[model samples]
Target: MRKLQFPVIFALFCGMVACNGKSGNDSTPSSEENIKKEEVKIRKPVDQAGYDVLLQYIANDDTTGLWPVPDQPLPLEGAVLPYNRIVAYYGNLYSKNMGVLGEYPPDEVWRRLDKEVEAWKAADPNTPVLPAIHYIAVVAQGNAMKDGKWRFRMPAHQIDSALAIAKMRKALVFLDVQVGLSTVEEEIPQLEKYLLMPHVHLGIDPEFSMKDGTPPGKKIGTYDAKEINFCSEYLAELVRKNNLPPKILVIHRFTKGMLTNYKDIRLRPEVQIVINMDGFGRPELKYSTYERFIRPKPVQFTGFKLFYKNDVKQFPHHMLAPEELMKLRPRPVYIQYQ
Candidate 1:
């Protein structure tokens, strides 16, 4: 795994106050009354219920850095758990090197995907399986585009095809984004309409988030906590506005540099986070990476990615079994095959 080239200049501005054309000491009784009236006129109604819930979960001084990983079927009062152990086939419709997703026709892909799903179901009989199609909505390209961003976004029809497959499987759909020169903030809103759907979730590939303007695949890229937090907050807002179950925000990482500021990430009840190990190697090497990179830095949940071609390229002739993966300390609740 390559290290991120830390930007030389990083600045954060905090809490600058604005003046309203009135001096601090110039308050007469009439002026004070007028200011109070103006404040009342502009103030928005408070969400008392939301505030009450926040207050209930508020941490004290001693518990400042002690945020617990959310449990399976995240308990959010009345909200129901949408899915439990997600098994997804990951890739795009255009690239064969990508994964099994684009290697075969739709019917054949679904047939193979169903077999994997059933294997997971048999392995984790206690948890219901949610089949998923993790489509690469945006792919990193070798050549830069007109904007000098070496990325090509799949058209809406490509995504619709994945959604249709998910519908056929009664599964969830994840639109994976690989931001080459673009920011997550810029790319995510483009999929807002699709994300608004109940069964659709999101996956952000930090491996292609080239923050330093380096073309993707030349070197591994990175995503700081701020970027990850932004995606989580965006999904949380959508959950709140739509009255939907908690949304899962998957961040792919197999190296330390791929994700930064792990402690500063804030998780909410409205969103579940999965820090997925996205590298492929021999079974032992893959397990070692999972242990070293992912398991040690536990997020709300965990995910492991398997590469059908890449995983067996080394000495090993088989991928890690679901039972072997389940034996991980914090078992991976989400599994993706590429």
Candidate 2:
């Protein structure tokens, strides 16, 4: 009798190698691998009537955080839950705390993302695909340009992998870009390749923009309507030239000063912009911030975000109801759980 055992590496390799494969490969996988390999049955889609609930939440602004971990078993109560409709914003691509995407091989990030998309689709077939594009800080290292030429600092392989995943899943991708010492206009041309993709979108980090010089300790410069519109106009033209759907332009603002000229930001009819109140730390500020700044933005699609363990502690109150938030006018389209 031959007692047999499959190695962990070999098991995962098989999972990727085949469209389908039988599990249980491991003489004794390390704790990490065991966690990563934990499997859960992908549930069937929720009822059709639930679609109305999803849409209503999107219109009204109801949402809760959904955090995906590479390892660990998901709760048995893994039921399909409803969240905000508009968009999702991901964070920590460049946070020194979170390793740069460059640190991992390109395909890995997207592979994880692919698994996430599959899970969402299984739980709710109609779930609109809204993935995130992040780590613009690694691109051009805060300058938004290199040697007077617009170039992305992130490895091309990473971007390619992300794009491939988005294309395959038909998911919307936001190309997050940080304007270090430069203006938003300067970063537009460099982002064209990504913007052209149907699933691709754009995100601007105004917190990284500095006045005298580069920003400090995750804090940077601010942006105004002038810079935002310049980039929007350029993207609007590009989207029309390609006969693609309206592009989603995202701006991260925490405080009033971050967007000094928000009143002047005249969003073009052709393009759609989302103002995300992206201040880290406080949760009480989330509602008020969204009410003050984002409510006023002309763009219909607005955004909100929650940190997995971080923000949850501050706001233990739970998910915000859509009917309550939407009445403010200019409803939010996206809710992010990072």
Candidate 3:
């Protein structure tokens, strides 16, 4: 529940609208033709059908063509995004400060969570909103544990407990890992059993990924494209072998350093990556943070994280509502309340 800092960023640019073009058979492409350059990154045989679905899912205003990144590979079998919106409660069962999932009693948590999902559904009537339990499977610690890694794994029984709770609401389960001093390479394999399940997914917290041997809270952490791609490829293999639905990978970020090499993050048929705006603050502060980190770089999907406690500590003494978030240029499909 440490309140990470968001850098002071200026919202510099506005979403560009598609412009009309003149075709007079000029050898050089017109400014209108070059407009797609900023919107679409890499060009590939686009899945026009699914891409159209992505546009709708984001509630994309025609102003920006960035929501449907041009070359995303088609998902196999059951893909969640563009078809459904996710409302997740994030935390570890042991720590109440981490998020809402652990702040209240089990029955109360489910009751509140169901109401949140309903709110999102009411906000966007066309999309089916499902609940998700994003449990912190690996927690970053101030002290180096027995393995000399500044982290500890939650008990398997606790994860089983999370699965049990998910079953109560038929919610999706996400195992989030904050790999303190240890590498994700060492951590991810340990959770393969749970991840192989059809409904379970993965989340990696870069804010706790201290690669320089510094303690987790000493400074913000980071994840490069190399590490991110590894996670996607790993999940893709799981989907291929087990014939399961596309796995959703959530990456937490508030500052630019929390995630790097945005252009290199690949889009796979079996894995969908969501760059979650994890910063918490007043409405203006949170919106600036989102535009700074998420908008400039378009990932496969997008997510917005709200804090029940941290958010209310500011001026308005309130949390960002579903209606307010929907106004984002590329609306977030995944909503996590901590």
Candidate 4:
């Protein structure tokens, strides 16, 4: 969970962030086979299937036919997008207000997560719902306390705890980052030990990436395509070096300024990119935010975020049901709850 007062903006693997410290292939040989099948579908000259999925995401209304993301590189085997939906619970262990992942004890968290996963499974029966834990590895701060980065890194033990929790159900783990005044180039490598594992993916939050020395939470931040490409290229190198499945890169947004030059963000077979719309508000407001920021822009995959508290804090205060979200244009393949 993250700051939502801005109320606008938008941003993997389904199960590849699998338990047992492996890619999706650890015990599921079939997943590789499925990727071969996906390859065939992905390589069609016209890419009609990809276009069709885009239509479904947008409720089949791409009259202009602009957004079936042309020439997307066929993902490496064990990739998780465009086939399965990843249902992730996001937060930091140090703050319950961050998200559901740390809001309760691990048992209660899993219980709630299981129920949510089931709902997604039933709502979009065609796309398998894979559970995941999206933990905040780098947290933004209100003040530039030390070195003026205005960010804090979680200790190794806490990240270990997240991995341990994900292993409980063979779930995926995504280490999210809020760079604050820091740069992705500077912050991401610190987590290389965990990221080297097959199941651990990456998320970079632009909302907290301040370039002008402003502290996070006071004002929103931004990331250009150049910076994002750095992350993609970095992950691609890891995937190639480790010979692991494709890595997922999640970018969070609710406003247009949070992400810029999206057209310049490169796509790679070694990585699956998800642009998740993570603002907290009523259904209509959230839907508008998605439409304003996520729908028109072309990305490899799309995601929707729901806020348990902020979404339901006011009038017509209720979270968007899984059933309702399925109706979104270019239907979201990723769902996050905070």
Candidate 5:
């Protein structure tokens, strides 16, 4: 782990500024049908000379730091992560009970999210913190729809709203899909347009991906490695075809049953996989769950989710600190506050 030099920092800042400029209008289309008609201009890869300079600086620098370096092992040797640390706000814009993301208006949400990001930055100054919006693009429902999917597909307007927020913050966006009674094959391709955006990523929640046609929230659902692999392959292909940087694919899990056949999930340079610990409980209970369910499984990267209300209800004292979470075997690169 090492801190990025001033030159590297400047390069990244310039790249981000350019990216923001390219992100045209913030206004969303009027309807979901029209959203498909609006084409997304593919992003070009980072300047090779600048990327090479940053890599050379990282390789030459020997300063130790409290956080891992972004792209430490290099893309050639299994490293695909773009940020040293990621802090995200998770939930849909419609439901406050779901998470903090929806608990406040857009301005307030950004304010709260920035507070968390600042905390992480202060805790680990060496690592660059990437702000993120983990939008619940598709929500599982108790009732079965006409298609019997038992899920509510978020309209493109909602997705665009999240993207607009992310653009304002110059942060990354993740569209989370809960495929109740539906297959990943059916859900993922629907978000292909958003996934093509440079800063937008993807997340699949196994806890709601009921393979048995059961309604969500009644019983824990499951996703096989085959399903996870499909997402990775799809994202990888997107990276290749668009000549963009690697895409991150987040998989939400808190129990063994949430993700089946984990051993068979494939990893590629074009796609970074994050096995996110998504359960909320007492601090000890949550840590134990992470150790048992997430620690044992070696994934490309790791993520942890914290519920602002649920976690505090059980703990009654305090939330897990960044230092405490960093003590895990493989430190989580992505953290979400729900």
Candidate 6:
């Protein structure tokens, strides 16, 4: 039951880190038709480092300053202390009109990513030190590639850039997958290389994942326990195969129908699963949603997201403090301040 002593101060830091990127596609035969059917061979997984810093922060509950270690230490003038035990420094990058991951010259993406890393390295220490969570998924619909009929397609180069940035920033990269026609299981192979990186993670959106019978964005839920398990097992096996530490699996839940088996999600002992209640527009709804779906999960970690403009309309610009959120069961190891 630790409270964020200076909730406002923590909110400022969280605000700086939450960045969400966007994705789209055009006319084609459809991904299923376009992709060649072949026996998916097990690629040799690369051995990556473990989540030492995050584990330490959670084990001891002592992240006093901003995470990712800023290049410079800014003044923490009137900041309060005795804050929450665990929280993540969410990083977002949803700029408009960007080139594709593979299509974009490596230098361009690297430069942009590097600049962000430096900014984080410099700004982090000035605030509280929370684990850094990078939002690597494309936020917009137009960003995804058109592979036949499939609208949202994740390109290979995109995943590579994400991994490179994650390694450089010493942060966790959460691949925000917008589930359209492709299922979670379908994207693993493409992401396998990045997921091999120590800093990589996954976030599934049931919001975009329409049920077999339901249309997109409908109240109908998209994935069930089976899909969730498929992801869990894949990540777990990758971690084990590469002799890497546990990896985090993030799932997005907004409405009651997004994910029906949230409470029943199988928790893998070797893997960390963060159920992030992603939505905005209303503070009451956000908090209410978190309480009902996230707070009650048996899992050890949870995530919360804050929108800059979304919260400004309803409640005070700054909503719940880090300390206040930490009080929730399992504590929030993954925090997305988007």
Best by TM-score: 3
Error of 4 at 261 (Å): 0.8
Top lDDT prediction, candidate number:
3
Q: Write the per-residue lDDT of candidate 2 for residues 61-96, one digit (tens) a residue.
A: 433221111121121121212332333425334343
* Model 3's TM-score against the true structure: 0.84
- Per-candidate TM-scores read 0.77, 0.59, 0.84, 0.83, 0.77, 0.59
- What is the clash count for each candidate, in the order shown? 0, 12, 0, 18, 0, 28
lDDT string, candidate 5, 118-211, tens digits: 9888876766898999999989998998998898989999899989888878999999999999888998999999999878899999999887
Candidate 5, lDDT over the whole model? 0.79
Give residue 243's error in model 1 in angstroms.
1.6
Q: Give all candidates' CA lDDT scores.
A: 0.77, 0.54, 0.86, 0.85, 0.79, 0.52
Clashes counted in candidate 6 amount to: 28
Tell me the TM-score of model 2. Answer: 0.59
lDDT, candidate 4, 158-222, per-residue tens: 99999999999999999999998899999999999999998899999999999887778888899
Question: For model 4, what is the error of residue 224's alpha carbon versus the real structure, in angstroms, after optimal superposition?
Answer: 0.3
lDDT of 3 by residue, 1-338 (tens): 22332222211111121122333445556575587764453323336576576666574763566766776777665788777889999998998878877788889999999999989988889788989999999999989989889999989999999999899988999999999999888899999999999999999999999988899999999999999999999998988777778899999999999989989999998888999999998989999998888887888788999998899997999899999888887889899999
Between the candidate structures 2 and 4, which one is better when assessed by lDDT? Answer: 4
Instruction: State each model's C-alpha RMSD to the native.
Output: 15.7, 17.9, 19.9, 16.6, 15.9, 23.0
Angstrom error of the Cα, residue 237, model 2: value is: 1.6
Better of 2 and 4 by TM-score: 4
lDDT of 3: 0.86
Q: lDDT tens string, model 1, 1-338? A: 12333332221111111133233434433445778976654323234465333322321121323223433223343222223688999999888989888898888988988898888888867667778899999888898998888888899998999888788878888899998999999999999999998778899999998977788998999999999899989998987777666678889998999999887788777777888899888988888887788766756667889988888888857888887876665667789999
